[model samples]
Target: MAISEIQSVAERPEGNELAGRVALVTGGTRGIGAAICRALAGHGASVAAGFSHDRERAEAFRAELAAGGADVTLHRGNVSSAEDCRRTVQEVVDAHGQIDILVNNAGITMDRIVSKMADADWYDVIGVNLSGTFFMSKAALEHMLERGSGRIINISSIIGQTGNVGQANYAASKSGLFGLTMSLAKEAAFSLKRAGRLEAYGAGITVNAVAPGFIETEMLDSVPEKALERIRSEVPLHRLGRPEEVARVVRFLAADASSYITGQVWAINGGQEM
Candidate 1:
């Protein structure tokens, strides 16, 4: 299908479901992260969209979001750095008073077969995709622990579950998120119910992941046309997933409706098998 023929999955948010909530979405300048940021803001959350670089695009994204009536700000930082992650979290809390939702959406792909993979390629993908999630989650959990309740939504990939050719490093990094999700969910539950210093979050907290497959985004621009067509042909839904479709799922997980769901993976893959 032509890109223009693909339907949009824009939000029709209602009831201010996330009103007064404060959220941070890393890699929020474009693609899935951008959609997630807009969805949260549309529901009345104060959002901080973080980008690693590309000042021009980030500024453009900021202006577009501002025009949409969102209470949004932009944060620039590299999530792979523990110190940077700590400072980013602290800055958000300092500005917004508290962070109730943390979407670990920052990631990258250094696709290569194991034999040909460079040292930097392996470490770079692992650092940004896996370690970045941990760094951000660790820093955010501190504030969430003290606050008594919170949400940590990790953005993983379908490759993590079933694996993929030329994606050894990517697969490993993403697969690691599932373990991290389950572990953190348990720890947060412990802190909330028993070991916690703050009793306000006795209501509990949640940590979950969203693993999307072949979303229609510029991320796939580098893929060859024939390969892309083959991917589309294999999907049970007969098409690529839309970014907003995935964002809606993230929004649901962030909302009160998903309060009971945690340590699980929600695959948004157009019914496609990994």
Candidate 2:
């Protein structure tokens, strides 16, 4: 499908699936992150979009979503820093009263072969991708446990499942999320049970991951047309995935209906790795 056509699909149907919930999305100003924010807000959830830089772009995004009648706000912080993660989560809670959803979408790619990859490149990617997810999840879990409910959705990549060249760091970071998701899921479940609230609140917090394969985002803007064509050819659907497609999965996971699912990695790769 054409990129414009994919993006022009109408907003999600108006609903109250998450009307009383509050969501905080990291790196939520653009690309897939922005789509997740829009999807959650469109579903009637109050959204707090977190950004690290580009104040102008962040403000524009907030304005656009707010204009659409979304109860959305912006928070600026680097997810790589534990302090920043804690502060951002607190800011969201302070602003909205509670955080029911946490989307760890803030990530960076430092593409380079291991031989040529600088230490900074490796650490920076890991710091923001994998470590950031952990920091944010930890911070959000505090609130979730206090309330006995929440959703933690990590935005992983298909590369995490199927390794790629020149992306060792990126691959490793994303793959790490799978283990983190499962472990956190079990821990959250056990903690709630120990606290004698497992069955008290049927909507306890859930931790899950999503792996998107070759989505049509700015990340692909610099790739050669031939490379893009090869990517498309490899996908069974013959087209790159859309951000909204991934966002829908997140929306589902965020909903109360998905309470039975946890620690699973939902793939949205157009059949590339299935």
Q: What is the C-alpha RMSD of each candidate to the true structure, in Å?
A: 7.9, 7.3
**In candidate 2, what are the lDDT values of residues 1-274, reduced to their tens digit?**
4555433322234576888889999989999999999999988899999999999999999999989999998999988999999999999999999999999999999898899999999999999999999999999998999999889999999999999999999999999999999999999999999998886327777999999999988999999999999999999999999999999999999987678889999999999996
- Among the numbered candidates, top TM-score falls to 2
In model 2, pairs of residues that clash are: none
The parts of candidate 1 lying over 4 Å away from their true place are 1-13, 196-203
Residue pairs in candidate 1 whose N, alpha carbon or C atoms collide under 3 angstroms: 148-201
Residue-pair clash count for candidate 1: 1
At residue 151, candidate 2 shows an lDDT of 96
Question: Using lDDT as the measure, which candidate wins?
Answer: 2
- The Cα error of candidate 1 at residue 116, in Å, is 0.4
TM per model?
Answer: 0.92, 0.94
Please report how far candidate 1 places residue 186 from its true position, in Å.
Answer: 0.7
